[model samples]
Target: MTLTTLKQRSLLGLKDLSKDEIVSLLDRAAHWEAQPVKVNPVLQGKFVANMFFENSTRTRFSFEVAEKRLGTEVLNFSAAVSSVQKGESIYDTVRTLESMGIDAGVIRLKPIGVLADLATRIKVPLINAGDGNNEHPTQALLDIYTMRKQFGELKGLTVAIIGDILHSRVARSNLWALQKLGVNVRFCAPPNMVATELDAAYISIEEALKADVIMMLRVQLERHENGMIKSAEEYREQYGLTVERAKRIAPHAIIMHPAPINRNVEIDDELVEHPQSRIFPQMENGVPVRMAVIERALG
Candidate 1:
C-alpha cells in the first residue's frame, strides 16, 4: 500500500470519515456478500487480533468469522482471561501483541480516547470494534447496509433510535453515519438517557413511530436501580416496544435493534422475529460488513 493508503488503514470513528468513504465501504460489503464461496482466502497468512476489553458476543464472534473467512490467522484476547486480570495496562496488552507481529487489530475498550491514543502509538492498523460510547463503526456500517438493502437508497429516510442514548456507542455511530448518508436521525429516550451533546432531534414515542425506521437500543437492566428508571415493568410500559406499540408502526416501516436483546424488556419476544424486525438480518449482515473492514485493514 502507498503512504496515502497506509494513512486510511485505521478506522477509529465514523465522525472523521466522509460520506464517500463510508458509501464505498458499504459497497465493498455488498461485493463480499455476492461471492459464491464463503471463504475467499484473499488474506491468507495475514494476522489479526481481536482484543476486547469489554464483554461481547456478536461483535467479537462476528470479527472472528470475518477474519477466518478471509483466511487471516486469528488471535483472541479477553480481559477476563488475559494478563489484564492481573492489573496490566491496556497499552501493555496491545504492545505485547504488537511485538509478536500482528498485522492488524480490532479493539473494544471502555475508556474514551484510549483507542485513538493507541492508534497513534501502534504501528499496525487498528479497527475500533467498540470504543467506549464514542463509536462502533462496523456495527453502524452493517446497519446502513441493512437499511440500503431494504429501502434501496438511504436518502430521506428517518430513523428513530428509541432507548438509552447516552451510553450507546451504536446510537452515536449510527447517528453520525446515517446523517452523512442523508438519513434523518432522532432519539427517543428517557430524559436521563438522552445525549445532550449530539446534534439530533429528540422526539416523543408517538412521533418516533412515524419514522421510516424504528431502531431500539438495548436497555441496560442494571440501571433500573440507578433511579433513572424505576423497574423493568415501568420501563417497558413507558419506553419498551410492547406488542401493542409494534402494531402502530407503519406496515412499510421496519424495526431494528443491535442485539443481545433483553427480549421482554426492550422489545416484546414475538416482535424480535417479527416480519418487520431486521434484528437477525443485522447480525447476518455483520459478517460481510466486518469482512470488508478486516480485509481493508490487512489486504
Candidate 2:
C-alpha cells in the first residue's frame, strides 16, 4: 500500500473519509477478525483513554475491549463520577487526561461542535465514539463492516435508516460513508424526527422494508424536547418494525440497529434477533472493526 493508503491518525467522523480510506479500515478489520489469538501486542506500550462526557454502555465497552485486545494500557474516564459533575468543563477533563500523557483518546461528548474543536487542540490522536448529533464514526464503521460481511460488496445496495434522524449520529455517519462505498441510503422517520440539514430521501416505513438493509435507529427520547414524539406506543404504531413489518422485509434483506434499542418502540423485540437480523452480530463485529481503527491511530 502507498503511504497515503496507510495513514489515518484519528476518527472523529466518517463524513471526511474517502471510500478507499474506509475500505482500508474494513479490510484491516477483516484481517484482525481472522486472527486466532485473543490479544495482539502490536501496540503493547501504548496508552489509550476512553473519555465519555455522555452516557454509553455498548460503545464504551466496545472501545475498551478493542483497546485491550491490542495490548494497550487503558484509562477510562466517565463524566458521571468525575470532576465534570463538580463543575469542570469538557475541555478541562480531556486536557487533564492529556496532561497525564495519554497516547490517544476515545471520546464521546453531548455537544456537536466540541469534538472538532478538541481535535485541533489535542496533540495526541483523538477518536470520536460519538459527538452529539454530528457523527459516531466507529459505530458507522462497524455497521458498514457488518454489511460488507453479509453481502460481500456495498456497491448498489439500498439501506433505509428508520427512527429519530434528527438526533442520530449513526445515521449521518453511516449515510456519508455508505454513499462513498456506493450504497443508496434513505431515511424514514416522523416529520419532527427528520433532520432538515441532510439531503437524503425520506420514505415511509412501509417503503423502507423493501431496502436491502433496514437499519433501526434508537429513538433518542432524551434529545427530543417539547414532546416531539407523542408517545412510545404511538411512535411504534407508525414507525416501529413490528412482527408484521418484518414479514414484509425481502427474505434476502438484513435488519440492523445501533442499539440500546427501544425494544418495541423503533423495532419489535421479536425481530431484534430474528433470522435476518444482524443486531448482535453488529456488536460482535465492532471489536475487530475498532481494533483496525485503534491500530490505525496508534500505528
Candidate 3:
C-alpha cells in the first residue's frame, strides 16, 4: 500500500487500528529496514518533540533515533526540569510547545488515558510512546516485526505473554495487535498480577513455554506498594524463565522481552543472552518500526 493510503492520524493505541492498517504499517517498516542506510527525508525540515513525563531508556532513545534518521529535527522535553514539576498541566505544556511550531509530539506519560485527552487538545499529531498501564503501540509494532522476521508469518502462532499483566502497557498493545493479526495470545501471571478484566485465556508458565513465542514482561516494582510478590527469588522460582524452565520450552519457540529486564528475576541471566532470545533484536527493530510510525504520522 502507498503512503497516501495510510489512515492513521495519531497513534494512541493499537486498539484504534485495524489488522490491515497494522500490516501495511509493518510492510512500510520492512521497506525502511531493507534500505541500506534506512534514512528517509520524508520528514525533512520538520520539528518533532519528545515529551516524556516518565523515565524510559529504550522508547525514548529509539524515538529520537527514528526522528533523526527520518531527517526531522528533535526537541527534547524533560518533565523533571520543566514547569511540569511546578504543577503545570499537560495541556499548558503541550500548547506552549505547539506555539513554538513543532510539527508533532511523541509523548510518554505515567497516567493512563492522558494521551487520548491530549490528542483532542493538541493541533500536532500525537504519538503515544507509553501511558501508565495503558498502551505502547510502537513497542508492539517492533515486537510483531521481530516475530515476523523470525517466523515469516503470524497466522496460527501462539504468543504467551508472561508476568505482570495487570500493569503492562506492552502486553495490552501486543494483545490487540497480535490478536488482530491471527495470533492466539495467552496471559500467564501470578493471581495478583493478572488483570481479570482482559478477555485472554489464563495459563500456567509451563503451558506458556510450549507456545510458538514467549514474551516475558518486567514486573513493575514502582506500582507495587504493599508487596504483592514475596521476593524476587520466589517470583523467579514460580514464573521466571530460569535455565531449567528454558530447557522445557519447545526447541522452536522463541523468547522475547520488552526490556529494562530484571536480569535473574524475570529471566535467568544465561537465558537472556541465549541463542533463542530475541531481546536485543527486538530493540534493534524498534528503530525501523518507529521510523514508520513517525513517517506515517508526519510525513
Backbone atom clashes (below 3 Å) for every candidate: 0, 0, 0
RMSD of candidate 3 to true structure, Å: 2.6
Highest TM-score scorer: 1
TM-scores of the candidates are: 0.98, 0.96, 0.96
What tens-digit string does per-residue lDDT give for candidate 1 at 156-261? 9999999999999999999999999999998999999999999999999889988899998999888876787888888888888999998899999999999989
Candidate 3 least-lDDT 10 residues: 1-10
The C-alpha RMSD of each candidate to the native structure, in angstroms, is 1.2, 2.5, 2.6
Alpha-carbon lDDT of model 2: 0.91
Q: How would you encode candidate 3's per-residue C-alpha lDDT over 143-203 as one tens digit per residue? A: 9999999999899999999999998999999999999999999999999988988879999
* Model 1 collision count: 0
lDDT at 54 for candidate 3?
86
